[model samples]
Target chain A: MTDRVIRLQEAPFDYGAECAAFAERAGGAGAVVTFLGLVRNDGGSLTRMEIDHYPGMTEAAIDAIAAEAATRFRLDSLLVLHRTGPMQPGEPIMMVATASRHRAEAFAAAEFLMDYLKSRAPFWKKEHRAEGPIWVAARDADEEALDRWAGGAG
Target chain B: MRVLYFAWVRERIGRPWEDVETTAATPAALADELAAREERYAAAFADRRALRVAVDQRLVDFDAPLEGAREVAFFPPMTGG
Candidate 1:
């Protein structure tokens, strides 16, 4: 079966391995755009970070978003993986790679995927700062990102 | 009537999750039920300004009905990425 999205257990994501996986699927594609999200060290002093999700809801929501991206952008293949639960700094939080016959489609789809993931997915974040763990609120900037994708002058 | 708090909402509420029973048949009613639970719940739900809720796995507004939902979740504006 053709696979477009993959969400898996929290582990050290190997970028080389993941890129190879994309190339394997991109045999007939001319261009590929990949975006990797990592836990920011924020000056290299973070103990750990935690991700909270709504289980079944999170997967379903992500799948739906991928489906939407596939429809909106002409893509040969798409890969998306997100991690949940507790995680330490420098860990791979999520990845999005899109393959297409042209760079425009691949890049647009990758950007679109990240933008949607930021605003639409049901994931929550808590930062483990030196002071203590603090819950971060969703930023208006993310919402504006979506609006820009929708052709608004955000 | 299992109510879940996720992410920062769970933090604000001082828990990872919670389950409660109420006579609420709609999302708004459930919010009311939660708001009336105790000082903590009320404080957690104090400003309904940016709070988002979900019935089952689907995002819905506070006025949405919850007739047959197995889970109801509450959280702040989503920050997923």
Candidate 2:
């Protein structure tokens, strides 16, 4: 089976390179779906953001998450990348690419992977504003997003 | 034992990470030990309502035994990508 997960640092990611990697690994796949989550300006209000992650634990968590997504959606391939350390506005924070024989599985898996990554990964974001450095609160919306995918075995 | 904090939990506690020797055996016991360290850890865990625990690298309940666990991590509900 093709490797179905990618997780790494907060460095610049090449969309083209990721696409090529997916194409090379995905044999006989008819569809590929990808999602990119950028560090938004958040309406130009925020100043800076810092992402923290456990060294070994972070990768393990992402890998487990990716593996689960692949199984649940029966995907042909999956790629997930998460950045750590300081990030400025408009930078890429993470990406998820999914490949499958059909559009349904690819799309669902990509979306599901993103949702699960947001709520389950070992990432912590701290925001800087004009006022001062303020750590962000975990949102209720995030939990609700993950809840949409509940009932599948852990 | 080593106690690690992530994200805002680190901020509230005023440190990103700390290592403390504990007589406690499990993650929950470690948490209690930390909570007793000072007001900072206590306040950091003031409302465990949104906090999450992980032993080694896998997520587990607070009460999950820490047998043979080398590392324990405490943090808020994840808000990753």
Candidate 3:
């Protein structure tokens, strides 16, 4: 398997299986870090999450982000998978995994990957509530988080 | 060129995408042209600062040239994880 993987699919992924597979694919790396995002059910009022993504741009943006992470952290391997379309609250939305020779490298790379993915990726989310569906607004915090990496990473 | 819309932009624009031929030279110019065509587009492009543009599937400034671009997309800031 390639060291870097990026996937966008509507099908839900098996978390346990993905982790085990990623670990194996990472091979001799001494450290592996992972992150997962799930739909948040707001006070039981949230019913679903609808993710819309640009077909060609989604893959391009993720690949570019992953490449940057790998270059900054010297990671041995990385995995990014995100789902689009409707998903129930509590279902997985996206995940990131990084493997590096050291713990710091793996951890930093994972965070960098996440911060960039949050606001830079061409994916928009809409939350379905009892009243109506509202587009999830981009938070200033996420943009700030991404800028924090401008000083550099790893 | 194929002009694409996503998320709320798509909803407000009333369609996912459309083929547009224009003398507009940049994303900003194209937006202005679209906004003039219909009330829905005007509503969508009303707050230009609230939207982002991509030329040929890559993010770029609103003033980026679209000379050779085959596609253009407009949407709000991303909320992905």
| Candidate 2 Cα errors over 4 Å, as ranges | none
Which predicted model would earn the best lDDT? Answer: 3
Docking class of 3: medium
Ranking of predictions according to DockQ: 2, 3, 1
Worst 10 residues of 1 chain A by lDDT: A145-154
Candidate 1 lDDT, B6-65, residue by residue in tens = 765676678766667676878788887777867877888888876888888788888888
Looking at candidate 2 chain A, the ten consecutive residues that score lowest on lDDT are A145-154
Pairs clashing within candidate 2: A6-A80
Instruction: Give per-residue CA lDDT, model 1, range A1-154, as digits (tens).
Output: 2348667566768887998989888888898888888888876668898877778888888887788778878888999888888888888888989999899989998888888888778887888888888777888888888876675110
Candidates in order, TM-scores: namely: 0.90, 0.90, 0.96
Off by over 4 Å in 1: A151-154, B14-19
Residue-wise lDDT of candidate 2 within B1-81, one digit each (tens)? 677888777777898677777777667778777888799889888777778988887889988888777778888877788
TM-score of the second chain, cand. 2: 0.88
Tens digit of lDDT per residue, candidate 2, span A9-83? 767787778778876888678888888888776657778888878788878877877778867886788888778
Best by DockQ: 2
